[model samples]
Target: MITATDFITIPYTSDLTQAGIAYACRSLPYTYDRMGGSHFNRLRRIVVGVAVELAFRRRLAEEKVPHDNLGSTPFTDPDRYDIAIGGRRCDIKSFMLTRRSLIRHVSREPQALLGADALVPSDQIVSDHLNDEDLYIFAFITALTTPNQRSLDRALKADQPIYLIHPLPKEWAHPSRWIPLGTLALKCDTSHAVTLELGGQNESRAFMAEEIVLEPRKRAAAESDFYALGYLHTSNPPDGIVGVHSPSVGETHLVEPIQWGNIWIYGMQIIFTGYMTRGEFRQRGNRLPAGSRVFKYSSTRTENRSLPIAELHPLSDLFTQAKKWAKRGA
Candidate 1:
């Protein structure tokens, strides 16, 4: 049966299809052709990495070959260390659209080819040298460089060095182009630690040391929408603290990491005033003394002692639908 799950193998050809597939793969908002340059490129790599990791996770659950996310490691840097997986040290490099151009432009440098070949070996070349258990690989993600016609045309025509290798070394007949399927085939090595080093004429660290890790810890799905509020807090909470569920579109949903000094809400009405858990909402805090309803939405309070139940049915339905959409998106 060609179930919805089978759609996983489909190759996206149109902008809408691509966006739809990507959104379904992960719910992060995407702007067509707008997000570019270095930041966007890096983001694209991360998203692609996450999506690929997810797909592998699913496959493994179904008893397919095992794999995991290769957290915070850039595969190309030599001195940057990662934990040895299966007794072999493996590095992770995220290859995006501009990556080809960068390598192509730089390959003309003396001994550039040698360094490139040794550091970022081509898939076919790696296949020849690597037995089933004896290879370090690059996890490449082929994100659409440009969604619009102008950008697409520019990228396609751009003479970037897409080919890191010359004519297949006779031993291996096929070359692994940066394509969608190639992204799926490669899995991040989870047992490896990641290190990113940035030192050149620019002379600045690109990825913060804290950002790289082998497992690529993710914000839980429940907390994905609420994590943004953490920054607004006066004092940041400790990391790894589970968030509290707050009223959202409907039912209570997980809030991201909380900051101290904020009012707690029970459906738009400030029911309580206190510090949101010391580090996490899961942390307990004292609730404010109940007072007469202050403002009126559906019910008005005659005296300062009476309170009214807030309308929650409509909001609950909305929250339910939001969760459904999230599930379908995956």
Candidate 2:
């Protein structure tokens, strides 16, 4: 039984959010044309997802935990294994609390959220796209207020190098094409989204994906709905880092880390619920068939394998385990 103490809270700041938006732009060119969603929605998810991954990395840094840099060369998507802790690869899964969920339990300063029923999406767990990392870290973003939008107007440039969109480079057998995200003109035919032409002369080898990717009016997220949380860079109460302890379900400070970055969450709180090892996931993940219910939806768009958020091991526990190895070397 997972308790509140199992959850770890990390501050998501403006700098990281902007960086995530920029990253979404930088990666749009090399992004995979996914199934069942518009290219724009995919972009928006990238914006928020990247922000979550960035926030986690920042927290690890402030805590002075040694880890490998997540940056991958252009054309190679290095984000799969979001981070490495004590040599263990970690894949991050994130979700934003719905307004209803927040209204029911969250307030200006509510107890640590218990998104116990939260889950990993179907597409992520299906046979082809299943993750192979050592750990799967899940986190939740507060829906306290509406998050403002950030557009990808000039984020992607013809010459800008792309990184972290797909795991492999163009040289690999399976290639994720680079396209002007919002510029595509598409039409659906027989359940396929075919690209007619692009708005810009991106020189992306005149590449177009046959997959049905609805063009998003906005390339990136307009905003991640949320409210502000106070942040400070000191060994004080306003200490930027906070944790939601278990059993008590109380929010409190974790440590006065050696954080040098702004580590701003602008106005949102990010809490890491827990993580499951690859083996544990394989052992306990419930197989979600395609068209089966995932969240509240009557059916999911794709097949998947998922686990309950409530059954995960604590983020604090991972930190504790990392410390043991950290003391030995890296």
**Looking at model 1, which ten-residue stretch has the lowest summed lDDT?**
265-274
> What does candidate 1's lDDT look like per residue over 1-330, in tens digits?
111111122122233223322322121122222223332232344344334433323433454222233353332231322322233333332223234454344223312221221112122222332233322222222234442335533543664211100111111111122111110011122233222111111112121111112122332122121211111111122232222222321222222322111111001000110111112211221222223222211221121111111101121232244355446655
lDDT of 2: 0.47
Best by lDDT: 2
lDDT of 2 by residue, 66-129 (tens): 7776554343253455477776677777766545655356444333444344455445554443
**RMSD, every candidate, angstroms:** 30.3, 18.1
Q: What is the TM-score of each candidate against the true structure?
A: 0.22, 0.56
lDDT of 2 at 202: 30
Best by TM-score: 2
The C-alpha lDDT values of all candidates are 0.24, 0.47
**Which ranges of candidate 2 are over 4 A from the true structure?**
33-35, 73-79, 98-104, 107-115, 121-133, 143-267, 292-299
* Alpha carbon RMSD to native, model 1: 30.3
Error of 2 at 269 (Å): 2.2
